[model samples]
Target: MKPKKNPELEIGRNSSLYFAIGLNLMLFLSWQALEYKTYDKDFVAIDILNVDEELEEDIPIVNINTPPPPPPPPPVVVETITIVEDVEDVEETIIESTEANQNDAVEERIVDVSDVDVEEVDEDVEVPFAAIEDVPVFPGCEGEPRNKMKDCFQKKIQEHVVKNFRYPELATEMGIQGRVSVIFVIDSKGFTTKVRSRGPDKILEKEAERIISLLPKMTPGKQRGRSVKVSYAVPIFFKLQTS
Candidate 1:
């Protein structure tokens, strides 16, 4: 014998629509039950009948004839105070200045501060060539007198510049002739660094910079017995030779 369940199988095929319809019907029933409220019809009818009533006012008529107000009260009397001047003169008080007194203890009172911070100064910093106690020494400048070392250093620098001086072909061809200020810093390690040049033309400045950079390393400058950097500036003139 074959088993048949056509009614239950057909209901399960589209169960979602039926479930939605039941949910809507349940919501509608709940809303109707929650919205159900009863009011006292007779009490509301009684409140409508108890409206406020207008009262009739009693206005009294007065006579036009009236006696004028009583006259104002008498004016008050004020007694004036007259000051009596005395013929005797008042003595002036003179205050003597303390500047003539030598009170040293009061002037030199010590003030102690609670908190003080000590800062550490960098000792390896660079001093300029003029301010340095000992300048950078060239190879042969060591044998010179201590006082004459400064002169020897300048002389050696001039000699080195004369030997390496070369006119840039570009600058010469363009007729760019001007005095260039070439600045360079001799580091603590006695090496030339931070070479900068400024002049009327860039070509002249570049030439001056090349000459300064080619300088050989020397002994580092000393300030207070410690090695320091020295800044050096020189002016290089590029004069065109007119035939």
Candidate 2:
């Protein structure tokens, strides 16, 4: 049984028509779903809002800080002095000082400083004594007529030696060693005068004078048959050669 195929029911021809219909339906539904999702995400309810309504709301406020005022400047101080005394008292004090100085000068002038005199006192020089000499008994003194005066001279000379002669003990004790020479005039009256030192030591000279002063007057020396006062020299030796 093979039946004849209808033209209208051909699979190939009807398949095209069914496919177009399905495509149209699927497109329409997809479009409608996309529109719905877009509208839901973006839409707002403007009709429910009340723009004119006044409502109280709490708002937070932030306060800014201000620095405190600077400290006050330090105080300024001033001092005052009052001088009450007059200058006249100071002037009087100065005048009194000057007057005192002038009065002191006038008093000094009245003092007699110039009237004082310094007297010079003269000093007495003590003449030191002389040394005694050892002499041999003078020869012609005993034999001649002039020898009559010998005894008198001997006593007088002894007295003179005792009174005027001084030993030079200092030289001997001090170990002083030297020679002293003396020059003197033997007068006609047999006295030694003007005794003076002719040697180095003046200390010995004094000693030499003491010795010469004790000498018995010498017989006047004859020169050209005339008796004349003669100058004579004597040397005294002081030594410690023994020790």
Candidate 3:
């Protein structure tokens, strides 16, 4: 089928001009409808001043001078009580040499010499048996020469042991026999003290100690002109006689 072209459709060709006219007309209507009113207003005042003739107010100032507060009272002084101690009764020792001439002044010094506490000395000094100048004088060895005193002392000790020798009953029964070593000290006071013994058997040692303890009080040995403690050792033999 063939389609027909209508001449009436050509009438819409000027519709663009209509659209432009409609748009301008709408713009003019909108502008006329807006409220644009005018009203009467009051004017604000603006002051005009000369810069050379300005006015300034004066501010009052006061000077203050007050005395400082008095210094704080002196601090309370606390007195300290000191206790006094009583003085001790101390004695001084003056050594006077008999042979010294009159011009020699004796030196004196304050010393706390406690003769009762001499044995309690802290340090023990050892005296050699051979180095003693004055050998400890046994009861009967006073008049003997110094060179033979040591020999005489040993002989006297042996004699004393023989006199006191009594074989321990238990040791003799058990046939326990040996040499016992006895050690003792002769103090500055010429008295025997600190007797100790060692042996193969206690019985023998006891006998040896008993004999040494019976030794007579002797003259204290002297070293360099001063009396000193002397140490001595003696050994005694014990034998079981066989029948």
Clashing pairs in model 3, backbone N/Cα/C closer than 3 A:
none
- Candidate 3 lDDT by residue in tens digits, 1-243: 889989678868999999999999999988888866665555656679768965888977855775788999999999999998868977899987779788989899776777336554433455867778888988998899989999999899889999999999999999999899999999887888999999999889988888888988898898877778899998999999999
| Strongest candidate by TM-score | 1
Question: What are the runs in model 3 whose C-alpha is more than 4 Å off?
Answer: 1-124
Which candidate order results from sorting by lDDT in descending order? 3, 1, 2
Q: By the TM-score metric, which is better: model 1 or model 2? A: 1
What overall lDDT goes with each candidate model?
0.85, 0.57, 0.87
Q: After TM-score superposition, what is the CA distance of residue 62 in candidate 3 from its true location, in Å?
A: 93
Q: Where's the lowest-lDDT run of ten residues in candidate 3?
A: 115-124
Give candidate 1's whole-model lDDT: 0.85
- Per-candidate RMSD, Å: 27.5, 35.1, 22.7
Cα lDDT tens digits, model 2, 45-135, are 5666558977889887866686878999988777789988885654344433444554465434555877889896543221212211212
What tens digits encode model 1's per-residue C-alpha lDDT throughout 42-125? Answer: 676433466688898998888778888899998998989999998899999999776755654555756567555678786657
TM-score of 2: 0.31
Q: Supply candidate 1's per-residue lDDT for 182.
A: 85
